[model samples]
Target chain A: MEESATQPPTAATPSATAAKLAMRHVDFHYGPFRALKDISLDIHDRAITAIIGPSGCGKSTLLRTFNRMNELIPRTRVTGDVLLDGTGIYGPDVDVAVLRKRIGMVFQRPNPFPASIYDNVAIGPRRHGRKEPDVQEIVERSLCRAALWDEVKDGLKGPALALSAGQQQLLCIARALAVEPEAILMDEPCSSLDPAATLEVEELMLELAQEYAIVIVTHNMQQAARVSSMSACMMMDPDRAGVLAEYDATSLIFTNPKDKRTEDYISGRIG
Target chain B: MRMSPRLSQNLARAVIWASAVLVIGLLLFILAFILAKGLPTLSWDFLTQNPSDMGRGGGILSTIASTLFVTLVAVVVATPFGVGTAFYLTEYTREGRMTRFIRFGAESLAAIPSIVYGLFGFIFFVITLKMGWSVLSGGLTLAVMILPTIIRTSEEAIRTVPKMYRDVGFSLGATKWQTIATTVVPSALPGIVTGIILAIGRCVAETAAVILTAGSALQLPTSLFSPARTMAVHFYIMAREGISMERAYGTAALLILLILVINVAVNLLVNRFVAKGR
Candidate 1:
C-alpha cells in the first residue's frame, strides 16, 4: 500500500489539472465501525473520475462524502478535510443546503418525484427561490443538457414515474443539472439500467464531464475504463475499513497498475 | 390418523369463505331491513322540513344541520393537530424514548371508549370551560375522540411513502421543511385524506358523545354557541322515548348512506391519486 501511494505519475494526464475537490487523510465511521480510512485524493474539474470496487468496499460511501451527504445517516462521523475549490466544507457555520446545492448527486435508482416531469426538474430551482420564468428556462435547458428534452418535450406535465427506467435515470440527471452545481456525484447510477440505457447514460456523462466535475462509483470496471479519465480502485482492509488501493490515469490503472491488488482485481483474479 | 395436507388446505379455505360470507351476509341483512322499514318514511318534506311535535310529525332538517356543523368543527379543528403530530413522529424524530412515549399515549387514547371521551368533554369543555351544550362543545369533544384515529392512519400513510423520495428531495438541496412540505406530504395526501374522512364518519355516527356534549334541541342551531342535536342523538332520543321508531329508522338509514358515500369518495380519490402517480 505504501509503495503504491508513492508511485510516480506516468504521463501528462488529466491529473495535472487543478483539483475541483480535494480530500486529505479523511476517515469516516458509522457508530464504532470505520467505513473509510486515511483516504486522500484529488478529483479534477472538467473530467470524469470513477471509483470502482466490489460490493462492501465503501465506494458508494466515498462518493457520498464529496457533498457531505453521509451526514444524513445518523451516528455517522467524518474527520479530516474535504475541500471544494480548496475551502473546507465541514465548518460549523456552513449551511448544508447551500453546500449541497453546489454539489448535486444522482442515486443508484432513478427516483423521480411523484410529480409532473416539469416539476421534477424544477424542484431545485424552485426551492432556491428562483422566479417562475427563470425556472422554466432552467428546466428546459437542463433537460436538453441531459439529452432528455427531445423525448419529453411534448409531455412536461406528465407524471415523471410514467417514464421508462432509462428515461427516468436521464430525468434524474436533468434534475441534478437544474441545480446548476459545479460538480455531480453519482452512486452506481446505471446499475439498475439495461445495456442500451447504460450506453446512453455513459454518453451523457462524457458530455457532462466537459462542463462539470463528475465522480461516479460503480462495480462495472468496463464502465470505469470506457468513460473516466482518472480512476480509483478501492478494496476493503483486513479490519473491514475501505482503503484506496490505487489511483492513476484510467489507462495506466487498467493496463499497468502499480499495485498488484489493482492488477488482480482488474484481471478478474481477485476482488 | 394425521390429516392430509390437501384435506387441511380445503378445510382452511372453507372456513375462510364461510367467515367472509357470514360477515357480508350480516351486513346486507341489516342494511336491507333498515331500508325496507325506513324508505317509506323518507320524503322530500321529511328531508327538508324541521321536526314538529318532538320529531314525530316533520323532517329532520335541523338534525342534519347539527350533524354537519359538528362534523365540520371536529374535522377542521383536529386535522392540523393530528397531521402535524404524525409528521413529527415519522419525519422529525428518530425512534427513541420520546417517540415511543408519544406513540404509547396515542395508542392509549385510541383504545378508550367514546363514552369516556364524552365524559371528559362534559367535564372540561362544557362545565369547566362554560362552553355549554352547543356545537362548539360537541365538536371539540369529538375532535379529541377522533384525533388518535387520524394520527395512527396518517402516520401509517406517511411511512408508506418510499424513503427514496425524501432522499431525492434532500439531494436536490431542499431544506428539511421544504422536503416534507413539497414531497412527503403530497405523496401521502390521499391516505391522510382517507383518515380524516374516517374520522368524519366517526363524528357523524357518535351518539353518546354528541348527546352529552351537545344538548338535543329540535330548533335549527343559528350559531356555534347555540345548542343542537346531531342525527345520532336525535335517533337515540326518538327510539328511547318511543316517540317514533319510523323516524329513528329514517335517521339510521340516512347515516348509513352518508357513511357509504364518504367511503366511496375516498376510494375514488385514492384511485385517482394512484393513477396520477403512474
Candidate 2:
C-alpha cells in the first residue's frame, strides 16, 4: 500500500533531493518469526523523518537496520538491501563498526555510561582510536551542539548519572553527536521524560535536523507532528509483521493520508 | 478470629527475634572465649621469634611469612585465569551445550571436598610433577581449589551489569572486547573484587590441601621452590600433637585477626572502585 503520488516532488515536501539512506525490500526476522515485512523507504538528509506506528510494529527495528544493530541479537536474520550514500551497507566488505559510527543511535531511556560527563562523551572517540589531545575539543563541540554545554559545562567532571532525566537524555544526544555522525536515529528518546523534558528534546531535534539526518521512532503522534518534516506510517499485518503503509510530507500525512489505516491510526480510532 | 491471627503474628516475630539473638550470642561467646584464653599468650616475642621445639615455645614468624607467600602466589595465579574464564562464559558465548558444560564443570569443582583436593594435589604436584612440597605446589593447588568460586561469582557479577550499557557501547561502534573492558568490567568491579576477597579468605583458612602439597617447614621460604607452612597448619600441628595449646590458641587468634584485617582492606578497595564507577 505504498503511496506513489508523494514519491514525486511536491511543493509542500521538504527538498525532494536524493536520499542519504535507502531501504529496498528489506525484511527482518527474529529466528523463525518475521518482525518486519518487505519495506522500502528513503530517508532524506538534513531533515527529521519520524516513523510513527503502534507498538510491535517494528518502527524501532527498522530504524536499527540502518546501522545493522539488530545483528547483535542471536539468531536474528536480515534480507534485502540497505544502502548508505548509494553503497550497500550489508555488503561482505562493509565494516559494521564503521557503519554504526557513521549512523549514531539514541536509545529510548537515557543510557549515559556510569562515568563523568566528559568521559561519556569522550568514550566514543576514544574507542574509535581518536587522538587524546583532540578529545577535549570534540567533547565541547558535541555538548555544545546538543544544547547541554551551558548546564553541564562546569560539571564535565561530575558523574553523568547525577543529571536529571531530561539532562541525561540530552547528554545521551551529546554522546551520540560526539562521534560526528552524518545521521542520528532515536528510538523514543523522550518517552521516559516529563512533559518539559519532552519539549526540550523535540526542540533539540528540530535544531539538530539542520545539520544531521534524523530518523525517530515515536508512539506519540503529536511528537511526530511537532518535530518531523517527513513521516512514515506503519501498521502490523495479519501475520504479526510490520509493513509501511504511507510515507509523505508531515503536513500531507497528518491532514489527508492516502491509506485508511494511517488515517485510523492518526485519528486514534485504531491502534 | 482476629485475635488469633494477631497472636500468631506476634509469635512469629518473637521466633525471629529469638533466632537472631541466638546466632549473635553464639558468635560473641566464641569470640570472647578465644580472646580471653589467647590474649595472655600474645606478646611481641611470641609473634617475632621462631618456634622452639616444634612450636611448643617462641613465635610463628616463619609460619606467618610462609602463609603470606603461599597466599600471594595463589591469588596472583588464579585471578587472571578465573576472571578470564568468567568473561568468556558470560560475554563471548551464549547459553548452549558448551556454556552449560563449562558451568557444570565449575559446579562440580566447587562441590569437591577439601580433603579430596588435598589428595589430588599430593599425588599430582608432589609425586607426578616432583615439585617437592614447596610454596609453588601449595599455591598452585589452592589456585585450582578457588578457581570455581572466582569464576562463578565473577560471571554472576558480569551478568548483573545492565544490558543497556552494552547496547550503548555497541551503538557507539565499540568492539566486543572494548565494550567489556571499559563498561562491563568497570561497572562490575566491586562485585568481582568481592569474589576475589572470598577466594583470598579460602586461601588463608585452607590447611589440608596446603599441608599435603607444601610440607609444614617452620623456616621462612626463601623462594617458590622452598617448602612453607601456614598459620592454620601450624595451629593444627601444635594443638593436635599436644605440643602447645597456649601457642595454638595464639595462632588461632592471630589467624582470626588477619582475616578481619584482610576483609576490611578488600572492602575499602571495593568501595573506592564503586565510588569511582559512580
Candidate 3:
C-alpha cells in the first residue's frame, strides 16, 4: 500500500477532514454476471476524487452505487456496504429518495427536461417540495454557483434544450446543485463536449470541489489529474470484472503508482 | 413482350399512377354523385326539423342529435380508461406475460367485426345489464369497441417519450407516479389525443352496433336513458327498405360532411397543441 503517497493537496483543508462516504467489500452483480468485484475506498469531504480507467471498467457503476441509482436496473443486486456520513445507504430503513437527494449525479449526456431553463434548475427544489418563491432563489443560487447565471439569467424562460451542448451540461450541473447535496457524482460529464467545453466543465468541477465532495469517473487521465486531489485506478480482472487497483494522491498515482497494473495503465503500456 | 430495364421502370410508374388514379377517381365520383342527388333535398328545414312518417319525409335533426350524443359519450367514457391502461402497460409493468396478454386482447378486440360487436353489445348491454336500447347503452358499447384502439395508440405514444426524460425525473427525486404524470404523460399527450380522435371516427361511422344498443328511435334523446337514432343507422334503414332514396343520399352527404369537418378540426387541434410538445 502506498499509504505515505496519499498526501493532501496544498489547499485549505476541509473543515471536517473526515470521510464523507466509505465502501466496504462492495460487490455488484447484474443478474448472473458480476460487474464489480469486492472494492472498498474512502471518499473525503470537500475533495475531488477521480476514478480513472478504460471503458467498461465499472467506474460509472461504482459512482452510481453511492446514490443507490444502480438499483434502478432490473435484476441488479448489491452486496456489502456503502456508507454515507457513517450510515449505510443500502440499509432497509434508508429512503432511496432521500439518499439520492443527499448525493446528486450528472450523467454523461446533457439531459435537460423539455422545459424552460428556469424550470429545469427549479425542478429539483420543487420536487423536494420547496415553496414556489423559495424555488426561484434556489435556482438563481444554484446557477450562480455553477457559473451559468451570467449567460442564462436573462433567458431563464427559454427552453433548456435550446442551449448549446456545453451550456446544457452546465444547466444539468445547476440542477444537481439546486438540491444542495453534500456530494456530487459525475460520470464522464465532459466526454461528449468539445475540448474548450471540456476545459470549462473541468474548471467548474474544481470550483465546486471547494464546497462539495466531488467524485468523477473519467477516461481522460489529464482531466483526472487537473481536477481531482485523490484518485483511484480501476482495471478489469481476468474474469472481466472491474476491481480497484490502487488509491492515492493524484500526483503520486500519476508519478509513482505502486501497482504494476496501475503503472502500466498510467504509462500507456496497457489499456 | 421482352422485359427491359427502361420498360420495367415505365411499367412500374404506370402501375403506381393507375392505382392512385383509381382510388382518387372512385372517391371523387362517389362525392359528385352523392352531391348531385342529395343537394336538391338539403335545406334549412332538412337540417333542423324532425323526421316525418318514419323518415319518409322532413329532416333528420333527431338522428343528427343522437349521432353527436353517442359519439361524445363514447369518447368521454373511453379516453380516461384507455389512457390509463396505456400508462399501466408502458410505465408500471415490464413487458411480460401479463402485458403481452393485455396487448393481444386489445389487438383481437380491434379485429372483431362491427356487426359482431353489435350482437355482443345487444346481449351484454341491452339484455344482461338491462340498460335497454338507449344512448347510454350505445355509448358504453361503442366505448368498449373503441377502447382497444385508444389503448394501443396511446401505448405507442407513451412509448415514444424518451427514456432519458424519465431518468431525469427520477434522479431529481420525483416519485414514480409523479415522474410518469409530469414527464411521460405530457410528452405523450398528442399521441393520446390522436387515439381519442380515431375512437370518435369509429363511433361516428358505426351503424349496426348503435342500432342494436341505441334503438333507432326517431326522436331527440332527452337523457342517457332516452332512446336515439344515429345517421348511419337511419341511412341503413332507409336505403335497405327503399323507403326514401333522396333522404338516404342526403343523410349520406351529411355524414360525409360531418367527417370532413371533424378531420379539419382535429388537424387544427393537433397543430395548436401537439406541434410544440417538444
Candidate 4:
C-alpha cells in the first residue's frame, strides 16, 4: 500500500515533539498469568498513535493502561510508571474519576445509554457537577465535535438506541467528549461498522487528532496506515506474553520496518 | 423402531397444548364458581360495614382493613432491605465465599414452609419479643418470609443489565455508587418492582402466619399494636366454624379481585417506565 502524501512528516521522528504520555518498564499480569512484558513508549500530543497486533497480543491491554482502565478487571496488576503530562497517574493522590475525565474512552460496540439522545451526551458533564446551562452548551459542542449534532439536533429527546449503529457510535464519541478529555482511547471503533460508517469514523479520527492525543488499538493494519501518525506493533512472546516488536511512524512501519517479525506480520506471513 | 420426526413433533405439541389448556381451564372454573356464589353477597355496604355476630350477619370492612395494614407493613419494611441486599450481592462485592454464603442462606430461607415460618414467628415475635399477636408481629413475620423472593429476583434482574453500561458509566468518570444508582438500578427497576408485587401477593394470601401472629380478632385494627384478623384468616374461621359460607366466598372473591387489580396497576406502571427508558 502506498503512503498517503497528506501524512505529517514531522511525526516520522520520535523526538520532534514533547510526549503527552510516557510509559517506562511497564509489565502487567492477570493473577499469575503475565499479559504484557517489559514495555516502554512515548506518545506525543495531538497525534493519532495506533497500536496494531493479532488477537490476545495485549494491544487493548496497553491502551487501557493509559487511563488505568485495566483496574476494572479483577486480579489484574500493573507495575512501573505510566505518566500523563509528566505526572504519574498511579500516584496515591490521584483521583481515578478525575483522571478518567481528562482521558476518555470509546469501546468496540456502540453502547449508548438507554436514555434520550440529549441525556446521553449530557451525562458526563452532569456527573462532574456541571449545572444545566453549561451542560446544555457542552452537549451541543461535544456533539458538533463528534460530527453528530446536525443529524440529531431536532430530536435530542429521542431515545439514543433508536439511532443507526454508526450514529450510535458517534453518539458515544460525543458522550466521551462531553467531559472534554485531553486524550481519547478507542478500541477497534470501526470493527462493528459498515464500510461507509468506517470511512466517516476515520475522517472524524483524523480531525480529532489535530486537537486531542488519540490512541487506537486495531487489528486492521490498513486502517493504521490510513490514519495514524505513529504506529506500534505488538507480538506475543514464546511464553504467550505480549511484547512491543516495533515502533515507528506509520509510513515506516508499513514500508521499512526494522524488525523482520514486523515485516512478516505486515506482509501477512505471520501474526 | 424410532418414531418419525413429524410424529414426535406432533406428539410434543399436543401434550404442551393440553397441559396449558388444563391449567387455564382449572383456574377459570374455580374463579367462575366463586364469582357465581359470592357476587350476590357483595355490595357497597358489605365492603364498608363492620362485621358482627361472629361474622354471620355483617360485612367485612374490618377484615379488609386488617389485610391492607399487614400488607403495607410487610412491603414497606422488606423492600429496602431486599433491594439493598440484591445490589450488594450483584454490584458491591465480588463473587466469593461471602456472596455464596449469603445466596445459600437466602435459598435455604425460601425453602422453609409458611407454616414453619408461622411457628417461628409465633415463638419469636409473639412470645419472646412480647410484641403479642398483633399487626406488627404478623407483618414483620411476613416480611421475613418474603425477603428471599425479593432478593433472588432483584439480583437476577440487576445481573441482566448489560455490563457495557457500567463500563460506559465508569469511563465517563462516574464513581461506583454513582454508576449503580443512575444506570444499573434504573435498568433493573421493573424486575425489582415485579418481585415486590409478588411479595405483596404472598402477604395478602397468608392465613396461618397471620392467624398465629396477628390473632383472629374481628374488629377494625386501631393501630400497629392492635390484634387483627386478615381476610384469609377470617375466611378460614368463617368456613371452619360454619358461621357463613356465603360471606367466606365473598371474602375470597374480593381477595382475588384485589390481587388482580394490584397486578394490573403495577404492569401499567412498569410499561410506562420501560417505554420511557426506551
Tens digits of per-residue lDDT, candidate 1, A1-271, equal 4433323233324543678888889999999999999999888888888999778989989988988888888999999999899999898988888889999999999999888999999999999999999999999999999999999999999999899999999999999999999999999999999999999999999999888889999889999999888888999999999999989889889998888888889999886
| Cα shift from native, residue A149, model 3 (Å) | 2.4
Give interface RMSD, per candidate. 1.4, 0.9, 1.9, 0.8
Which stretches of model 1 miss by more than 4 angstroms?
Answer: A1-16, B2-5, B269-274
lDDT (tens digit, per residue) of candidate 3 on A193-270 = 999989889999989988889999999988998989888899999998989999888887899899999999998888
Reported per model, the fraction of native interface contacts reproduced equals 0.59, 0.65, 0.35, 0.67
TM-score of chain A of each: 0.95, 0.96, 0.96, 0.95
Docking class of predicted structure 2: medium
Name every residue pair that clashes in candidate 3. none
The all-Cα superposition gives candidate 1 an RMSD in Å to the true structure of 2.1
Q: What share of the true interface contacts does candidate 3 keep?
A: 0.35
lDDT of model 2 at position A127: 88
Whichever of 1 and 2 has more lDDT, that candidate is: 1
Question: Mind sharing the TM-score for model 1?
Answer: 0.95
Off by over 4 Å in 2: A2-16, B1-3
lDDT of 4: 0.91
